[model samples]
Structures are given as C-alpha cells and as structure tokens.
Target: MTGSPAPVPDRATRIVVVGAGFAGFETVRRLLRHQRRSTDRPIRVTLISPDDFMLYTPLLPDVAGGLLDARFVAIPLAESLPGAELIAGRVDSVDFDGRTLQVRNREGAAETVEWERLVLTPGSVTRLFDIPGLAEHARGLKTATEALYLRDQMLEQIELAARETDPAVARARRTFVVVGASYAGTELTAQLRALADEAARHRGTVPDDVRFVLLDMADRVMPEVGEKLGDRVLEVLRGRGIDVRLGTTIDRLTAEAAELSDGTTIATRTVTWAAGVTASPLIQELGLPTEKGRLIVGADLSVPGDPDVFAAGDAAAVPDLAQRSGKGADDAITPPTAQHAVRQGKVVARNVIASIGVGTRKDYKHNDLGLVVDLGPRFAVANPVGVHLSGYPAKLVTRAYHLLALPRGANRMAVSAAYLGDAVFPRPLVSFGLVSADEASFPRSQGIPAPDSD
Candidate 1:
C-alpha cells in the first residue's frame, strides 16, 4: 500500500486557438514567437481549423478578377506555424465550464481536446437576409474557392454571351450585379468591370454592353473613409461607367435577375452579395451575452466571467478605447475591419501569454490608420494617416499598403510579379471550369447553414 500510490500524470498547459483567419493566424504566430524567446513554463499550442491555410481575403477581388493566382494568396499554416499542433477540424461546440471542445475533424470524426486557455477568432460570414432566391443564386467573395469560381463563372458567361443569338439573353449574361458599395463590393465592381472590358476587347464586343450595377443602402459609397473621400470614390466609379446606386438595396434575387428595392429589376446571371458580415455561428451557440451578434469582451479581450477565454476579430465586440473619449459605452466598439483584426490579434497573443504567467497583460488600443480602395488600374482613393489622395497617387499608396500588409514574403513577391505582368500584358481570358455552381454556393463555401424549407 505504501509503494503503490498511483503515479500522477503530468501535462503541459494547453492553449487552443480556433479559426485560421487573420486574427487567429497572427495570434498563433505571435504566441509561438513568445514561446521561442522565453524558456519559461512549458506550454503546448494547438490551432484547430477547417482549412490548413490562412487566406489573404483582401486580395480576393483580385483573384476573382483574374489579377492574381489563387495559390499565392494562401499562406500554408503547417509551414508557417512550426512547433504548434495543427488540427484540421471545425469546432462544433465548446464546453466552456469544462474547458473542453468538441471538434469534428476533416474526415467527420468527433474528438475532444482540453484547453487551459482558449482564443476564439472564428471571424465572420456573409450576412444573409430573408430575401427570396438569395441563398440559391447569390455568391460572396469571402473564400479563395468563391473567388476562383467567380472568375470562371464570369468568363464562361461572357463566352456564352458571345455566341448567343438573342440580344436580351446576351445582355443578361453580360450584366453583373453587386450588392454593398463598401470596400469588398466596391473593389469587386471595379476589378470585374476591368475584367469584363478585357473580355469584351477579345470578343470584339462593345465594353458598354457589359453592365455593372453597384448597390448599397448607405447614402455614400464608402462612408468609412469620410464623406469627402467617399464622394471621390463615387466619382471614380461613376466616371468608369459603373452604376453606383446609393441608398439602395436588393429586394429579391434569382438565377436570371435581381429585384431592387427601388422597383428596378436587373437582368443578370451573377450577383455578388458583399453586403456585410456577422460573426460566426459558433458565437451565437455559446449562449453568452453579445453585442450585435459579436461576443462581448473587455478592452483586454478577456471574456466577462471566463478569465481563461479570450476573443478578438469580427467575432468579438472589443471596446474601442482609443475612441472612448466622449462616446457612450455602447457606441465605443471597434468596427470589424481587417486592420483592426490584425492589430487585435497581436494584443490577444500578448495577453494569452501573460495569462499563462509568461509576461504582463496589456489592453488593446489603436487609432485609425486611414483606408485604401483600389479601383482597378491607375485609379484609387486613399487616406493615408489623415491625408487624402485620389487617382494615380492613391493607386501607388494602395498597392504599397497591400504589399506591406501581406505577411508572407513569398506572397508579396508573387503579388508584385503579377502586378508587373498586368501592366505589361493583356489578361488571359479563359475559364478552367474547376469550381461548380453548387460548390461555390454560400452554404458550401462560407459555412452558412442551409435555411429550413417550408
């Protein structure tokens, strides 16, 4: 009895991160860097995601418009995240009280992993509405697959239009409708217009025949960049022959047409729904208090009652301490943008390390660093550090900003080469027919659950 006392098992502190978007990827990278620098307490880091790569989503419009190859924008998690256990799985649920997660791996097998500390950065999905035919025909630019599919679909439609005997059918095939005049929708409209123009030149068709309609409920195109800059973007878009409809939105969508709220029905085969995004479904399933579908967390990103849990990015409603000077508490939250997400990721990493006794905790605070909108070749609108610029000068700042923002060196080089090639040569107009319509649908690509049929 004296010799047989059971040997207690020893386990290192486990930290698990969910999702591989900008926030999660950056958090994991920073955490590993901290771990490498310090020889302190032994801790195991694990990243669980359905994808094995971190997608550079800001460049998705370029991919959709055939400006860049798809592979270059994807950063492989396994290679970039050394010394961390990469689990290819989607977390189905989390037992917050028990400190365990129920994950369904790529092969659809259920597994459970315990975590002493957890970071939630599942990101956001396309905010869908109850409009008819939307879920069936509308697509988004959130994933690389969707981008590739959009490129192929556009080319295929243009090719089909070239041989069509019916003028009405041809017009419908060439028409492209994009909702949401914000960053993603605006950039996509500009790039796709360029793509359609190039396709028109090769087909010996009038570029004007290819119609582009950009819609938004907001009064201005991109209100985030202030009214003056937003007005400049509107001017550039309209000057380039895009139908920029402010204070407008789609009422319904169909495979062949989109019905606008203003009683206009646009006949089109493609509808890119870039309206906006809401936090991932997992946040709602947690049964916790949320502000506008995002988890409520302190300025330091820690969950209210759960000290071991932290959330950032679009999934978390992080207080905007930098802007909290005179605003109400409810109004002082960071807008869910890529810039904020990237900076928030770093803060989350630092705090997570501190929670495990490796360092001291710090609150997240950052001022607005301006915005950039690339409107095709030789045209852009940028406000760099509060100085507004338009046209060619803005274009230079926009490109440089992207190149610097891209994390991987290889990606930056590849993107730079693509830009140079774009300047020197005509774009190739061909579709490989790789992604099917069903495959690129929102339910399949962006993880939106199919609505219940009545």
Candidate 2:
C-alpha cells in the first residue's frame, strides 16, 4: 500500500505479515534475510502489529515479580529488522477472495490493505472461563501492562498487608493465588512468589506466613509436557513454599476469595489467571474452515481453498510429527509453543517467497526440541536437545535460549542487566495504568497494515 515501487514490485509480490510475536517476528526476520539476497524482483514486506515492538512474552513474569525491567521484554520492531516495513497498526479482518486485509489504525479508523501474499501469525491471547467473578476480579499477566499492574499490586499488597490490624483481613491481603499450572502459570507463580518473598524481606513488615497458592484443575503441572515434567515442576514450586493444589478448580470466585470445588475457600485479594491461550478471532474473519478457531492449513502453510492466504502460530492448526507418522490418522498437530513457531516462521517465509515465484516452496516440519521452564532464578527444568536438565544448568540454558531468541540488538544485554539489577535491588515498579482486566477480556483485533512510513 505505497507509491509504485521503483520496479513496480509486481502487485503479487507484496506480502503483509500480521502480528509481531515470536512467529510473526521470525517470519519477517527470515523474509528480510531472504530479501537481502540478490533477487530478480525485490519483495516488499509490510509487518502490521499493534505495537511497533516484539514483546518477549516468555520473560514477562519476571517483569511482574520485579526480577526484570519493563524495557527488557519489548524490542522495537524497526531496530530488530531493517528492511521490513514495520507499521504501527493492527489488522481487523481478511478479504480472502480479494487477497486484502482490513486494519484499524491507532486512531481507531479502518483501512483496507491489498496484498499479493498475507501471512497471519497473530499468536495467542489469554483465555477466560465462565467461572463466577473470575474475569472481573482477577488480574492477568499476559501483557506488559498486566505485568506492571501485578508489580504495583505486589508492592501495594505488602504495604496493605503490613497495616491491617485484623489478622484474617491482613492474611487475605497477603495471600496471592495463581490459577493454571501450564508453563505460563507455573513460571509466573514461581517468579512472583520469589518477588513477594524478596519484597517482603526487604520491607521486614511482611511475614514469612504470607501465602502463595497455585491452583489448577489438572492432576499435574505443566500438563502439556506430560506427567513426568509436570511432577518435577510441582515439586519445585511446592519446595518454594507454594501450595500446589492439583486436581482442583475454583468453583466460585469473589473479590476476596476463590471457593474451590472441594468446598474449601481460600481468602485472597489477588488472583492471577494464566490458565491457557486460545486462537485469536482474527482467523475467524477469514470465513475459512477451521479447527478450534485456528485457520486450517496444508503442510505447505497455505489455506486449502485460498492460495493467496497463509497462516502460522497459535492462530493456525499445523501438522506435527505424530500427524505425518500416522498418515494423518491421529493427525497430531503441533501444540502451540515458541519452539515450533520459530521454525514455522522460517518455513512460512520460504513458502511465501516460493508462492510469489521468487523460489520454490518448502514444507514445514519439526518435532519438539525439548522445552525449558525457568522456575525462579537458579531453579529450572529443561529437556534441551533431549537431555533433562534442572537446577542451575537448566536455568542457564533457559536464559541463554531466551537471550539468543530475542529479536533485537542490545536487548539481550538490557534484559541481563535487569536481571542483575533485580538480584541486587527490589524489582523496579512502573505504572502504565493501561488496560484493565475487563478491556483485555475481549480479544484484540489485528489492524490493516500501514505503508512503511517509518
């Protein structure tokens, strides 16, 4: 959507990449790498994302717990990738037949964008259930703002906990409950508990009696990784004084407590929900066949009926090793994870280039490369390269992986510095006051991409 290119960039050669998460960022990065090479017809890649930065969502909990600074999690888009047009807007809908996308600018106005190729890698959003009073009362840690809020709330909780004369009310104020035992929930609970411990220790007014509870309906933590890893994480969290409540759920939630299905209620002022993620509704706008809201795609990463359209990330249902091995009987699609998304982005970029005649297409394939979950600082669990690693070694591998995976320059250093700073001092607190639990409840919209005016 710009003035005619010097070579008129054949209308069919234009690609619009939506979302700037791990998958989208890698997609654009891989594309730019390819574009840098000499090509007969140059490709123009425009990236449309709500923010002009790629958020390091993996370390977000650290930010909340005061273990890292806010800036550590956000890498500006332009600085990360040189050639791609990093637009600061969001895509609203897709016109599959027209090969166009609709977007809303920061000003709330809508525009239509035509593309020769469209890659949707919008990624995941926080999931909500119908549990009473849960959405309104509990805060979310999915975004940077949520992290900031949780930090402020932690410090404020310490202050409030120290003041209430009634022991029960004070105990309720100090108790922090996190729901969901998946990676995000476990990591966030562990980190925040550490932060609370450190912050309380520094204040000296907060007591060792302060409580942290992590509740989930599943029988084990990290269920996505299977029972073995789940047991390991549960032990780690419980060892840190976190009450691990498995095979449980909050039947009712009040502003002050979560009533469990066991008929027992825990009084607490703060509830953090990291239960899981769902595909964005943007995929629904395509009016294409889908499985569980994710746009269904072929092995080549193209929509079955819409060749001009492509999708990856949590927004897509992609085949996995299990699926291909079984001849599509089980059709075990890869679950959503950063490891797969990064690889998928590379494949998607090549396929988009091939589709536009710049090269040949490649099918996407990758089994899990093992996973790393950092629980607090030196405590972590990783099955890296197929080796089960825990304690300091796992922590080292986890940090290194995230550092290497981060998109931009000096960000790795900045994040490392923040970690060091947190070690020496309490986590710094900043308040954006943006996005309430209510606003975040609704799924975000991806906007039409703007021309690379930057």
Candidate 3:
C-alpha cells in the first residue's frame, strides 16, 4: 500500500499533513518510503484534505479541450498513497500553540484533531479583484469542476448559436473571452481556440469565424517565459486569429459583454478568469508570520520558532537560496511553480523526519530547470536548461515532460491513449452535464456571511 504496516505511534508523535496538492502529496510519499525503511519508531501519517484526488493541473487545458478524459488527470489518493491515512475535509483554522486543527467536511460537520507534527500545504485559491459582475460572470480554471463546466458551456453555447436565426445573436454566442496571460490563461485560450476551430466545421450555420479574445494587464503574454518566446507565442495566436490584447483588462463585466479599460466592449457569453492565485485562507488564520498571504518559513521549510510545524508550496513563502544573494532575502521568495513545489515537498519531508531525530535535514535549494508552454498539438515554447526551442521540437519536449512527470498508472495510459486517439478520430464533443460549481468555486469564503457594520 502507501506505507509499511508498522505499529501505530502514540498520539504525541502522530504526523498530520494538511493538503493533497503537489507539496503535501510529495511529503507524504517521501515519508512513506522513509517509514518503510526505518525501525526507529512507528511513523503514523495522516492526510487531511477536501478532495481524495490530487489533480495533475498541467493537463487541465487538454481536458477542457476534449483532448484528454477527466479521469486521466485525477490521481486517486487512497490507491496511490496507501501508507498514509486519508481524511477528506476542509481545514478551517489551526491553533499552532495547541497543535490542533479545526476541519469541516461536505456534510457540514466540524471536528478538531490534535497532532504532534503539522505540515501545512493548504495550496492556493484563485486571485480575484473588485471588478463589477466579474465574480458572477467569469468562470475559474483552478479545479477539475471548472474545466469540465467550461467544456459544457463552450459546447452548449456553440449548439445554441448554430440554431439561432438572428445573425447578431449567433455572433454574440460564438464569441468567447478569456482574461489572464499566465500559463493557465494562455494555454486555455490556445487549446479552446483549437477546439472551436474544429467545432465550427461540424455546424454549417454557425460562422467558421468564431471570435476568441485573450486579455491581460501584463505587457506581454506569458511573461514567465522569455520575451522571444512570448513574442513568438503572440505571433502564433495572432496568426491563428485570436485577438491578443496586452496591458488591458476588464473594467466592467456584464452578462452580455465585457467593457475594456480602453473604451471598447466585446459581446460574448463565455468568460474564463485565470488571472492569478493566492495562498489558501487557512494559512492566514494560523497567526503565523506571513509575506503577502504566504506563511514565512526558514530554509529548512520549518515555521520560524515552531520546531513542530512545517510549511511548503504556494501556502508558504520559502526563501530561494539560489537567488543572487546567498542569504535568504526578502525579495527571494521561491516562485510558486510546480517544479519548486515538488522539490520543496521532498525537502519538507526530510526536515520533518529530522525533527523527529530520524535523520539530518538540509536546506531547500535548487536552480530552475526551465519552462514549457504547450501552445497546441504542433506548437510549443520551451527553455530547457537555458536552451530555447519552439515549434515541433518544443511540442515533443513538452509532451514528453508531462508524460514523465505524471504519476504512472492507468491514468497515464488513458492520457496517452486520448492524445493518440485524437489523431485517429474526431475529438469527442459530448458534454455530459455531470460537474457543477455551486459550492466549489471559492473555497475559503463559501457559506460565510459578511460582517455587519458597527
């Protein structure tokens, strides 16, 4: 299973992990391996999270575009992590001094659990602003539910547009707008544009010239990548007829259209918001030192002055030791990328073990390998170890990296089959209305009422 069937530890040494994203998952995984090899003590590990699956977020755009099935990206926690105990619940708050966590589940039940060692990897939530009607009108792409819902919405809009006799109504329904030029927004825009291209061919009445717009407040698309690659990506999107607007954003969003800051408006029914993400709200409730909503931890990934507590991933502002300044500087917080999170997770596990006197701990340090952006099946931009590549070779490297990085199992096979099958057959357009977003959208503030003015 996930861990060795050793004797259970007493309540005092119980290890409780607080998330199931890349950081927490890797922490538990490394703990299991070390526990199996050690005879020092019974390492009782427990994981508490809202969902039982660790979503492989990189392939979410492909899933939304019908290039891959939803099941392929959802790695089952119970099956993959048998060594650790799983508790499906949402953490409300943490009492650092008391070493207790208040958690609530889907059934509206709340409970408190005490632990000896606490690992906080609560991850992050979508970053939203105070724009009017933006929350109600725009959809997020952080979770699987959002991805699936967007797919259905896209299909339903196209279907409804094809039947509309009014030309103006049809055009409005065919138009789609996406805000955010980060990897998530850019990939979503690129993949969905590919889907829309093929979708138009099936319906004769719907104009083949369906409009797709990409907007961002940044100066260029995917500023995370090099300017050369960003320019190339911008050129590619423009060549494919995607209206790429930079240094612009939505001033006001209505159900019918989005008003841009430049006194322009676009009529559309679909709006996907992928602008940014912030640390999970649960982190702030802990009363720990924080930098911009992220828990501040030492190079060892342990909370300052709290030897029993550790934090990592997007939830923690871990210092980047590989930065220009050798000392941990205020401006050298590690970037919230999957690569850093994965490596940080492993380091947290080792440090936690060392906290229990099992082994020695090392400082969290690593240089970035590179970045890869999947523009589409044949187009990609990548900088692997300072070497930049684009087009077919970049696409190949991008796909290979994902395949190698994804956890091995039936899910990997399913993902591979879906990619191969897309070339042999028409991509599936069926939209089974199975996923919903009524309660899952913004997790931390859900069901909580605003405070009354004194």
Candidate 4:
C-alpha cells in the first residue's frame, strides 16, 4: 500500500447550502478557507442555486442605468468555492429528519440530496402585492434579466417619446413612477433619470421634461437609512427632478397610468417594484418554528431543536437586541440587509465547523456599520461609521465599498476602471429587449400547483 492511496469513503458527510446569495456565498467561503483537506474528511458542501453566480444585488441599479458592467455583479461559483459541489437548480424543500433536499434540475427533473448538516440560505424574493394592472403593465428591476429589461424599456420609452408628437403619449413616456424609496428604488430612480435626461438632450424629441417619481408608504425615503439620510435622499431625488412622494403608494396600476393614493395618477408606462423582499417559501417547508418566514435560530445561527440545521441572510429572522430592544420593546428582528448577512455567514461557518468536530461554536454578533446609497454618478448618500456624507464624497465611499465587497479582486480593478471610463466617456444610451415589456407584479409564478406536495 506504499504506492497506492487509501480508498475513499463510500458515503461522505454532506453539508448542503441552499441559495448562493450573500449568506450562502460567505458560508462556503469560510468553510473552504478554514477546513484543511488533508487532515479532515472532505466536507461535501453542495450549494444549490438557480444561477452559477452570486449577484451583488445592491449594484443592480448601476446595471439598470448601464453605468456598471452587468456581468460585474455576478460571481461565478466555479471561480472559487472549492470542495463544494455547485448545482444550478431551484430547491423545492428540505426534509429535516431525512436530512435531504428535493431540488429540481435544469431539465425540470427532481433529485434527492442527502446531507448530514444543512444550511438553508434560500434568501428572499421580491415582495409583490396585488396592485391592480401592475402585473400586466409594470417593469421590475430585481434580477439581472429584469435590469436588462428595464434598460431596454427606458431606451424604448425615450425613442417612443421622441417619435410621438402627441402631447399625452410624450408625457406618458417621460413620466416614471418608482413605488419604493429603499436603496434599490432610490438608486434606480436617480440613475435612470440621469440616463434618460442625458438621452433626451441627444435625441431632441425625448424631453428635458422627463420626470421620475419615487413613492413609498413610509413617511420618509429610505426609512431603513434613517431620517437624516432619508431627507438627504429626498432632496437628492428632488434635486434631479425626481418627484419624491412619501407616505404614499400606488392605488391602482392601469395600462397607461398609475393612480396614487394622493389623488395623483401619473400617466406613465414604467413602474419598478423595489418595495421589499420576503423570505423564500422553502423555510415554511421545514415544518420548523419560524419568525416572520425566517428560520428561528439561536445566536449560534443553528436552528432551534435541530442540531444539524442552520440558516442565515434574509431567510433567518435574527434577533436584534443591541440596536433594537429599547425602553418598552420586546423581541426585535434584525434588519434584512447585506451587512448583517455577511457577518452572520462567517458565524454560521464557524458554528458548522463545531458541528463537524473542528472547533468551538461562536454566536453571530454585528454592530451596525451604516448603509450607503448610490445616487447616480456624482450624487450619493452615505452614513459610514455613523458619519453622514452626501454628494460626491459619499459616492466615492459607496463605490469603494462595493468594489471591496465584490467576491473577486480582479472585479475590483475592472469595476473601478468602468466607473472611471463612465466619468470620461458616458456609456451610450441603448437597450436590447431581453425580459419582455409585460411586467410582473407577483414575485413567483401564479397557480404553480402549490409547488407539488412531494
């Protein structure tokens, strides 16, 4: 047996991580970095995601405006994440007791994945409520496909607005209503408005009269970004000719118009849904106790009553006692943000190592490192280190943070260069229709037969 290597184990202790978003990506990153292949039995980490890349969702607004390379946001799983099997598919459910997951493959076939330890980072989906006609008329900007679609729609609207001498159709094409004031919505509103405004000048017919309206049910823009920055964002949006509508929402979405609750029906064809996100339905499938559609876990990031099960990211309802629990408050859930997700993922990995007999388990704890909002080229709002910054400096910090957060180091230089290139020669305003103009109001397919009881 001197020359021959030892025979491999027939059954490996598998660790399956579902969803390759912020949580799943970092979880796998930590596992591979910490685990030593020679001394340790190969930890079979299988990551199940619909796409091979982990999308940096915050920068999706830049993609929509064609300011950043669309491919820059996606990190291919194969680039790193060694020893982890990456499967491209939608996972239906996980049977906790059986330690198995039911995932549908590329060919729409089902396969069973047995695991010793499971990390359910199924992430969140866009929350689309029943707004009348919105499903038929709106254009979403969530996924890469949606971003591309919106870009085409914007360019289409500009061209159409240019061709039309009709005052009504021209105005309709110019007006855009964004039904959320969160980071995604705010950034999209600012960037797209800037892009369209520039295009309008070049085309001559597309209006300098182009308008954008950012609406939210909350009293202030970016309610999560705090009142100070929210006010600044409101100002920034308004400064860019984007009408900031607060404490308001769309009452009805018609084929050619959006009727607002404030008795304002904007005649427009574009409505971007960036209101919020809800946890994946896979969490409910576990038959485990969940807090607000997220798996309820202890500080250790492990599922309660189940030793092998773990959860993180937007899917996990992490308790926030540090920043939340005040004078009269009871239990408070952590805000579903990327900052929390990244920190929680590492903690999850450490805990998983403990489960695998590597080291001691540690609880997830993160002090808030404030948020940054990218509002087009030179305009941005940031509250880094609890210090408020607006205009240009904030934009610099925002871009830098995203560059640093990107999965690959190569992407950093490339992303930075593009930003510089845009500063020099702006990207030509053009759109290729990828996702159809038929907008989607619902997050997932309607009447999917309850996803099958299997």
Each prediction's RMSD to truth: 4.8, 4.7, 2.8, 4.1
Native RMSD of candidate 1 (Å): 4.8
- lDDT at 276 for candidate 1? 95
- Give a tens-digit lDDT track for model 3, residues 1-454: 1334346646426889998989999999998887778766557788998887888888889878878887899989888887787887888888877888888887879989888899999888777788987877777887888888778788888888878998888888989999998889999888888788678766653434688899999999998788999999999999988899999999999888999987899998889888988898787788778998899999999988998899999999998888746645647989888888899999999999999888798999898888888887579999998788999999888988988888756887887788788778877777887765453344323322212211
- Backbone clashes, each candidate: 0, 9, 3, 0
Best candidate per TM-score, number? 1
Q: Give the total clashing residue pairs for model 3.
A: 3
The TM-score of predicted model 4 comes to 0.92
Lowest lDDT 10-residue stretch of candidate 1 = 1-10
Error of 2 at 221 (Å): 1.2
lDDT of 1 by residue, 1-454 (tens): 0012112224556889999899999998998786576655666778988888999898999999899999989988887887778888888899998999998865779999999999999999999999999989999989998999999999999888888999999999988999999899999999888899898888787889889999999989888788988888888889888998888888988889899999999999999999999999889888889999999999899999988999999999999988886454646899888899999999999999889887788999988898988889788888988999998999899999999998899999999999999999888776788999999988789878887642
For model 1, the superposed segments whose C-alpha errors exceed 4 Å read 1-10, 326-330
Candidate numbers, best TM-score first, in rank order: 1, 3, 4, 2
Q: Give candidate 4 regions above 4 Å deviation.
A: 1-11, 205-207, 324-330, 438-454
The global C-alpha lDDT for each of the candidates, from Candidate 1 onward, is 0.88, 0.77, 0.83, 0.78
**Comparison by lDDT, 2 against 3, better one:** 3
What lDDT, from 0 to 1, does candidate 4 have?
0.78
Highest lDDT scorer: 1
Prediction 3 TM-score vs. true:
0.94
lDDT of candidate 2 at residue 157, scale 0 to 100: 69
Q: What is the lDDT for 272 in model 1?
A: 92
What TM-score would every model get versus the actual structure? 0.96, 0.90, 0.94, 0.92
